[model samples]
Target: MSIARARLAVIIVSYCNADDVDRCLRSLARSDLDQFEVLICENGGEAAYTNLLARLVGPDRILKRISNDSDVLDLPQKRLASVASCRFQARANVVRIGLAIDNLGYGGGVNAWLEPLLSVPDWDAVLVLNPDTEVDPRALSELVAKSAAGYGMVGGNLVFDASPDKIINYGLHWSRMTGRVIAIGRNAPVGSTPSAENLAKIDAISGACVLATRACVEDVGLMAEDYFLYMEDLDWGLRRGKHRIGIADKAVVRHIGGTTIGSAVTIEKRSDLSIYLSARNSILYARRFAGWRWICHFGIGLLYAARYLIRGSSSAGKVALAGLLDGVNGKTGRPKVVPGAR
Candidate 1:
């Protein structure tokens, strides 16, 4: 098949959002292109949804990327660039499902499941979609077209899946003073740049939905699995900074974030694994790619975060401080593997 006709895979790394996964697959099934394949990596599920999905989509449309993910979390390290060994099927767009298996955290899980399809000879691009999302009909087309035009990776406006009016991510802006990261920009309208260049110039878009080219993988390498979950997208963006590629406004997606963490995040409290990971990962991100600027970036970030935690933020504070010390001390320790931690 021609490059244009080459299959574009969608990797859906699921955790516990069964209802959201159902909605996500339903949207994908209703897509204009029915030829694309779906790969469900059922990592750690009490009730396996892949079987139900296979029944709904029929076996042919669903490619079982991993059989009986009995101990999907057995070897976390194995999920990294190490899993890039499985080959892709011809003319097939494999959408990896990682729900019932071990939680590869964020980066590890996504990279692990996608290894199969990215191995394909004619595979052109892979779209990573969070499970709690309702994708726009033209999102796939926009991403593929732009990537083909020489933009290696692209991102788009993310409307909140719950409330479409308020955008979840409309690109990102780096605050010079507060050193805080902001999502969504004013004067948002969709189209290519004035020069008709393909890549989106936005500083940082949400990973809730991203369309990445094969060359981007070759150039930047895979997502850093060291971070169990948070900041993987920022790391990816930082890597692309080396090559000057970035988000594409043309690729539009709607996202429902924080599903992997827990619905408890909706509460006002700021102490938990969710908050802990965010605090820890921020420091981890600084150590890996930021060099000296990390000091300024994270210092301001700590102050901004302190405003949130105010009185009850001691748990996250301790985790963040510990992680920062570990990072600066040249340890950069891996997260202590909790037996059932995803």
Candidate 2:
């Protein structure tokens, strides 16, 4: 008989956000959780990320194609899709980095690490984190604790990376009565002191920093690849509606929102692209789980988009439009990347 040690796979997904990735990796090296490996899915440049990731995880753990062997079509699924750590090395808590063949956007990028991690029968959980996030030293510990306590999916409190004292997302809530999936901890002041309730209730946790158990994923399933760039976390959250989602009050991570999706757009405006996704995904979300409430939810989304376009800044207006349109066509994946005209 053998005693199995708990194992965690940390997947960092990024594209052209090298600066943020550097800080994120550095911050992660300080985490209290020791039984883990860090796998970075580089949708950006392999050369640049190689050295940086090597410091935290180790050179052998970092996986990617050399500059001379770059290929585009085989990205996402191809990026670091294997786990080669022996029990002894993993018990020591080492992290590995991986680079994709092509950019797999959001959901796909994270899933790529699955191929490698899942193959390792002993690995217990996969924590998908955006590379632009900076987390507290105790963040990993808190998430791990939450899972062991039995809440399959646990999330950390995210704050604005630039302003660590500002709340980004604490947990999410879905009010069946109002047909709203709310961010329960949004706008809460970030500080040393806080109430118990603030950490107690979670509606839907975001993918920016989430801890997913192997059991939860196998039963509820992985994120849908169709939601390439957004809402996949919330979508996954809905799948586990019967169980209470957990949030750690002490686990704090700073996120530079939209580092990969470009700048933050205002809630208003008709960018066409963004509106499409917001609209389409919202409809898909409502219909998939909310049943009869889909229509009402869709109408609410329209009003939400309308008000933004009518009153918010021009940029905000564009965001409203882009999200709506993106939702409608079932359009997902990163916005097209264009080369500069230098």
Residue-by-residue lDDT tens digits, candidate 2, 1-342 = 222334887888877666677677667767787777666676655664554444334344322322211322123344553322212222344444456666676777777776645655777778888887888999988888888888888887789877787777776665554446567666677744335675455556788898888888777776776766666888778787556677666788888776565445544222344444555567666666677876677667767757765674545444555555554555545556211101
lDDT of each: 0.55, 0.64
Model 2: ten consecutive residues of lowest lDDT:
65-74
lDDT of prediction 1: 0.55
**After superposition on all CA atoms, what RMSD does each candidate show versus the true structure?**
6.6, 6.5
C-alpha positional error of residue 270 in candidate 1 after TM-score superposition, expressed in Å: 5.3
Clashes of each: 15, 38
TM-score of each: 0.72, 0.75
Cand. 1 TM to true fold: 0.72
lDDT of 1 by residue, 1-342 (tens): 111223676777766555666677767755655445444454444354444344334335322343322322212234422221111222234333334345566676677756644554666776777878876666677667767777766766677555655555555544444435566543334443322221243555467787777777777778777777667777776677444344455555667677666534432543355555665566566655566676776676567446545757554555555544544454432356321122
What is the model-wide C-alpha lDDT for candidate 2? 0.64
